[model samples]
Target chain A: MPSAPSDSLRLRVDVPDRVAPGDPVPITFRVHNVTDRTLTLYLMGRDIAFDVVVERTDGATVWRRLEGEVVQAILRLESLTPGEALVLEATWDQQSGAGSPVAPGEYRVRAELLTEGDPLLSPAAPLRIAPR
Target chain B: MKSMALSVRLLTAATVLVLAACQDAPQPLAPEVSAASVGADRASDALREVMALDRTVFGGQDAAGQLVIGVENAGVASGVRNVMERFGIAPSGYRIEITEPIHFATETLRTVHRPTRGGIQIHFSNYLCTLGFNVDHAGGRSFITNSHCTAQQGSIDGVAYYQPTSSTDPNPIAHEADDPAYFKGGECSRGKVCRYSDAARALYQTGIDSNAEIAKTTKGVNSGDLAVNGAFEVTSQDNSSTTFSGTVNKVGRTTGWTAGNVTDSCVTVNVSGSNIQLLCQTLVENASTQIVGSGDSGSPVFTTDGTNANLIGILWGGNSSGTLFVFSPFKAIQDELGTLNALTDGTGTGGSDGGGDGGGDCTPRGNSGNCH
Candidate 1:
């Protein structure tokens, strides 16, 4: 007998208006359970693959992920029953010294959600920064 | 039998839970519409209805009560066209007219006002929302446009100038200061002095890239330029009222003014062209009814329905597809004029036949012109 689908699984992230170069951008992901059965949820930032690029308003561009380690933090939900929610947090630091200093201007942050053997889900957010 | 019954109950509950979870997630809200995509056919009808409604409610009153001046002569039209063409506005698809003229007299002069040899008009190529105005400050009177319009002092009307500051500053210092960041071309306009307003600074809080999304959502009909003629006056101290929350009727040159509802509080729209990018903000009105079209730039946007129906915004640019357009808040412009110390007591009451100088008084252009 096959098990049923899990409708309780969901994800969300929070972002800010601006960030400085080398500053840490804190991102929070939440998983909620809407079903009655307990679920074993395995969530890892590394499991997802997406492109990240930062550019100035003038067309100059740089690859954000290439300059620094693609840091990942693991989050596990041993058992989440119906109406339960879990939180996962991670920080993306604009690693300095490896690449040119991110110029001052409007920048874009893109994140894609993916699963093994599944199509990718990508959503992008923009942030403005006043360089120090 | 009892144990089997219990097991079956548990399975059923589990199945129900799984099915519920499998249901689709809530969809995100639909993006707003652009003024361009509203379609010419629908916009024309909406414009007619708004005009009819305005006459019935206001008792056949013109925009004069609202302190709007009409630009209607060939000299005015020719001058405006020259300005538009020099700014790279394609003349084939769009029309430019100076429906009014500026009248000045020697008796009204409290201070000697000399016409500077070098006066340049700032142009935003990509973004249609940006507008041009004259700025009066301690140093002198200068033309103003979006910082993104020009990089450094480029010649306009034989005047030498420089990019002073970015419009995004919250508390921008009026006089030019030493900051390489302030002098960048993409961030500042080239003129005698680049200036930004408090409203523009506040608008910068909203993300700029979001403007593209906003424009994509509220498009208007036709791809060419539009013109709007109406006067906007400050009715209250809290210039914050600059963003009026109400239904408004807009009258423009091409698809004469129409009526619509404002949706957002203060929206910043970026109009991008090959040579210029202008960022402007205005009260976002979402009207199930259409009200404006191309060649309506400079149209006045106001509400005749509410007590606050005073002058609110000046039509600058919009997206036809999403039924959304951007205007400069009247308060912002008023405040800019005030900051420059240009609004003289006499100039306030003076009547001129020049563009934007006619104040809010309305005179009919066509014989027995019916507003409706």
Candidate 2:
């Protein structure tokens, strides 16, 4: 069965400014649409072309995660029309590439819609990872 | 070295001029000592320069219409004074307080917080919120934060608060402080943002580790100072408005310890699109950068006499950027929520020691959430 249409279209991301080291942070991606035309977004294993990157103010890439770690199968393709909001969530456990806990500082977390060639990057969200 | 020699000579010349002018006015003391240094037009210009070049200091006008500067100690104070002097501005009628000294390689005071005060973590379900302050209210020991975090619409007594869901030690140090087995008392109330207040009251277990200390240190562990000395009555006693201008430091789960200036005191803010206006907000200027942020609700914003945490307000909400942090007045919380007592105001007893280490089962940094 096909889904219905929406009314508005807007993409937004929600992130926690503070994290307790080992606790995973949940970053929510919301897609709101308000119109008659239907917008299709591909969902590969439930991840809709989502990518979260945590960088220092110097633009140094500290942590990186892509949608569905190495997608194995296609989950479902969804369509968002006018006035409908689509949401997807990803969790980052406050760790770096060295598998070490990221030190406390000001970090910029950016989530993007890279499902297609042209990617829409959300304004970098300021997140602070404080001590437990 | 050359600057000091120049300042001393300049200050001597300026003092003679100011004293001569006031000598005949019957005013023995010069309140505006630095008037001659920077008249009126050059004052603002001098301030902008300090904001841009002075690294160790953050200066602003206090509510009492006085210039206030936050610094690490006397060392930076000399440099700041010299810089201002260069612009022909004397620091008369200016209040220069101290900030945590930046001594080490690390900047974030991650482990530089007191469990019961600012920079604490309180968990309800899977979410975590920062604690505003620990006080004794209504004859019961309680810790406060945003109502949205503790009360959350349908929050009941014993909703439970994990002093922190995370532990610094290998063994967890955070425990359910509100459980019957613990502090056994909790109050959660969710009021409309602007209409009322968004504050929660979580009663503590008698044995729960609690204190009125604020993280005054900008470094690690207890190596720096973080304690609450005195507080202001932002409700009935508004005479201390000047002190509020010095709204400098805040310890939160996310931002650790950040100091800045509160530009606007009373404001009605519409948080997000909630339609509800958050009343009585203390605006932390974007110029001061990120002082509050997500998951920092209920965190305590305060000032320090280098060692004491002078109570200010409890954080509520901010803009999407988290730069425009909004807070509810402490007096408003006392009036609406109805319970609050400082653990060590020479009054109620929540903690045994002042500026001392946190209690048993926890080390200097505190137990990891699992109970060390």
Candidate 3:
């Protein structure tokens, strides 16, 4: 798993506790290179990818953010020196793969960074929506 | 009466608003620092200067997420700032802290002469350091400690080292043995690549019986009876023991035995005026008292499981307030010293235990039982 304080990497993600169905979901991650050498890591649109996953309490995947986007369209690389970190932020328009607003009910959602075939997933946070 | 009650409520609300405004407001948070300046560059610049300074200190991230340099004393602050200016870094970009000055007024742990880890101290011409791992290279028998311990300009051959006498004796048990067969010190663990450490080795006279254990005492700090199981195999294998979190321990001449957490693994630290990068370090902080003291230099750092122990690093120095203690990893010592014959008991062979390099194992000589 891509975790902070791994042999050479520290990946910490921040997910908000609550958000409306139609609002953009903000995702933030902090990546640190804890090794002694310089590191070239994938930033985006490549193997180093993040997924916004929404799942139900029954363990069913309700939605994925990168459902049909090009996985390799905007591949980016970030360089980090030892003890350096990068704070990357992105936002989701609260829409699912089907382009429909998610009906929230304490839905479990998280951010995952796929690195070196390891899925470093953030702790799932609750996205609540009132029946307005 | 209803109108009066309304008026009272309004007055109370107004008073609360006024009081709230009068309260000191917290300053806005600083903007996020860029990754390179705050991360690698700052860390890299912190290494050599800290080590050269010979003051025990570590580089850490401030709340602003920028690299802040911490020193052990005020004397080191100006020297560090001089280095900072070389990098075009402003004074505000760093922090100077004065922790306790280690290697000062000292006390004896136990009477020397035992195969124990404590009570044995290394003495230079005018300085003294606590002895660390009893190691040998090739066939020359020697011991390992911080490079700054024997900062002799030339050969330290035949330099006298000391051990405390007994509990009641005013004199030391062993004093003035100059057998400096070979000595090497490291100012930087890794030059510009990554983190490194400060280490030194001294080969002395043949008769003294030294072991791998640090002097165990029921005296200072985490004072108690303790044993060194073996060196951490970080130079050979990356195990759970070398993680950045969790408890780490050490036994020193000045501080006796104390425990602290492995907070920062990869960081730059200040020693006197020089900076030395540490790939893995444990910030030694005592629970209630000072974790380290003067004459604690070269003390062996270890981790224990109530019975067994694993060697990690050696005592270098610490801050005055005991807020920070810095150590050199066994792996770094091995990297600079080449082959070190670790002294387990008086019977140790002092051969290279593969000193924690890339999943290696210790030789049969390791007395701590497990090598990995």
The candidate that wins on DockQ is: 2
TM-score of chain A of each: 0.49, 0.75, 0.67
User: lDDT at B321 for candidate 3?
Assistant: 35
Q: DockQ for the candidate 1 complex?
A: 0.02
* DockQ versus reference, model 3: 0.01
What overall lDDT, based on C-alpha atoms, would model 3 receive against the true structure?
Answer: 0.50
Q: Write the per-residue lDDT of candidate 1 for residues B118-230, one digit (tens) a residue.
A: 01111121111122222333323333332222222111112112211132222211211111111124343432122222111111111111100001001232322222111
Candidate 2 vs candidate 3: which has greater TM-score?
2
Model 3: CA > 4 A from native: A1-132, B1-110, B116-119, B151-158, B165-195, B219-243, B274-280, B346-372
Question: Fnat per model, in the order given?
Answer: 0.00, 0.00, 0.00
* Residue B215 shift from truth in candidate 2, angstroms: 2.2
TM-score of 2: 0.42
Arrange candidates by TM-score, highest first: which order? 2, 3, 1
DockQ scores of the candidates = 0.02, 0.03, 0.01
- Tens-digit lDDT track of model 2 for B239-319: 123225644566665555666667777655543312234455566645545555445666676656555555767776554
How many angstroms is residue A126 displaced in model 1 relative to the true structure, after the best TM-score fit? Answer: 34
lDDT of 2 by residue, A10-128 (tens): 66778887876677888987777656677665332222435678889899988877421221111123677656777767778888866788878888888765431234466788887
Model 1 misplaced regions, further than 4 Å: A1-132, B1-238, B274-280, B283-290, B305-309, B339-372
lDDT per residue as tens, model 3, B267-348: 5553321222334555655556556655566777776664445666776656533435777677666665565656444433
Candidate 2, residue B227: Cα displacement in angstroms equals: 15
